[model samples]
Target: MPVRRDRLRRAGESAFGALLLTRMILMTLLALLMVTGGAWSSWDTARDALRPPQGAAGPLTLAACDRERCTGTFGPSGETVALYQRIGREPGETLEVALRPGTAEVVRTGAPGVLYACLPLAGSLLLAGIVIGGGLRMYRTAWATAGAGIALLATAFALW
Candidate 1:
């Protein structure tokens, strides 16, 4: 009877120790995920601010086929432009302007678009990691404390 009781106590202690170690590992992983996500979000915001405009318009040129249609190239890069008049100045006229990019925008505002698209996914992942880690740590601490109390009671009972 004594030998069997000793074996059972040892097995319980070993299981408790394993559970505690697993909880600590989970906490560490969650902290790392939070740090990485924050760094990536900050980097994306910085890249969007420095972008420059594309396709400058120098001198406007009127089209031969239609006087209302004007085309001109602008900037040192000589970006092309095609303008269509929607509203005319005289009665029965339209006014409208359409600008198309001859070259890609400088500095790239697209970074924010990419970051925002992934933000929800990353945020959910980070939230889950934190909750799971915290919950595990709390459970481990409670279990360890309870185990210590039980061990003390067992020792007192044996001594008596």
Candidate 2:
């Protein structure tokens, strides 16, 4: 009876080990690296947005808007700046914003800025789930991470 149990344990170990091959691990690592690279590309903007805002602060008088962006004039200087990928803004509406130093760009302040800043991380987490589940065969972790990402996105939408 003991011998039979030992054999069963060995069989289980072998089956588990089959999934942990060198090639599989390497492939999984490569995929994760790619995902990391993509995330890093967006980290710059996200990092800036996440920080306490600096530079000029005042109302932006929006002049023109299309689907991708809105152009506006900022403060007393009337420096032209732009806001990208944001919604609920109408032309000619004066929204409070801050200048991104050394550039003709602006970001929202307060709750909206913080919420928008989190978007990149949310997207990266969503992508990581695919890598973890498919390449690394970690379904539980994948689901948890992806769920967290989705929840963040939903929360931002509800509150932003």
Question: How do the predictions measure up, each by TM-score?
Answer: 0.33, 0.70
Q: What is the overall TM-score of model 2 with all chains considered together?
A: 0.70
Clashing pairs in 2: none
Tens-place lDDT digits, model 2, residues 49-150:
556255466788999998888998887568789988666668898876767777888777666666676777677778877777787788998898789779
Error of 2 at 80 (Å): 2.1
* Residue-by-residue lDDT tens digits, candidate 1, 1-160: 4545688898999999999888778766665565466556644433342232343322323322244543444234444444433222233222122233442221212333233323333454445444454655555544443454355434433332
Question: Candidates' lDDT values, in order?
Answer: 0.42, 0.74
Q: Which stretches of candidate 1 lie over 4 Å from their true place?
A: 1-5, 47-133, 136-160
lDDT of 1 at 123: 51
| Cα distance off (Å), candidate 1, residue 155 | 57
Question: Lowest-scoring 10 consecutive residues by lDDT in candidate 2?
Answer: 46-55
Candidate 1: which pairs clash?
A: 86-94, 86-95, 87-93, 87-94, 87-95, 88-93, 88-94
lDDT of 1 at 136: 51
